[model samples]
Target: MIHLERVNGDTIWDILKLTVADHQKNFVAGNDVSIIEAYIAITSNGYAFPFGIFEDDTPVGFVMIGYDKDEYWKDAPAIADGNYNLWRLMIDKAHQNKGYGRQAVELALRFIRSKHHFPLTM
Candidate 1:
């Protein structure tokens, strides 16, 4: 069963070990970087939720969601004023092309919806 697990001390190493394909390395940031960004965001008074994508007991990928009004996206664009952004989504190279990415996205969306009570744009 594919599900999302909170990225904590117990699971941080497993999430950090996940990586994308060589061709995708340029596009996706490493899990370590994402986790660092999450920490920064949280410390800056922004909302950041980082999760490990898992299939049963095995870690398969990572996803992060962020919500900020003026701290992170103040000058970016009008659409990002107060929306829940999918900051990161990464499936390890070995776990690619198996529908885990899609399932993980759906799970992330569901998670975002569950946390916020307002209308979501994405």
Candidate 2:
């Protein structure tokens, strides 16, 4: 029962406390840093969105996905418009290896599909 919820004041405290294991710390940036970057993007006219991964009523992980249209597409032409970058996905150490990551990704893909942002081809 994994679902994503927008990061709001009610969930910010729990989100801020989420973390990875000490050994895997170098693998990804901390959630706090990621959230800050998301906020900056939100305020800077970028398409950054942060979400908290939940299992039932518990917050077990976090994911941020969006694209900076002005900056990201400038350097790379492969990514088409309406495409979103999966910026960050982190599942806390306490609840890892339980298929949550895969479920989260599936949900994200479904979300993108639902947006119908891709340009139709003739």
Per residue, candidate 1 scores C-alpha lDDT tens digits across 4-118 of: 9999999999999999989899998999999998988877777788999999999999999887543654565666557788889999999999999999999988887787554
Residue 33 displacement in candidate 1 (angstroms) = 0.5
Q: Say which candidate scores most in lDDT.
A: 1
Off by over 4 Å in 2: 70-82, 118-122
Candidate 1 Cα errors over 4 Å, as ranges: 69-75, 117-122
Question: Each candidate's TM vs. the true structure?
Answer: 0.89, 0.84
Residue-pair clashes per candidate, as listed?
0, 0
Model 2's number of clashes is 0
Which digits, one per residue and each the tens of the lDDT, describe model 2 over residues 43-116? 66567778899998899999988763534235545673556888899999999999999999998787766665
Clashing pairs in 1: none
Can you list the residue pairs that collide in candidate 2?
none
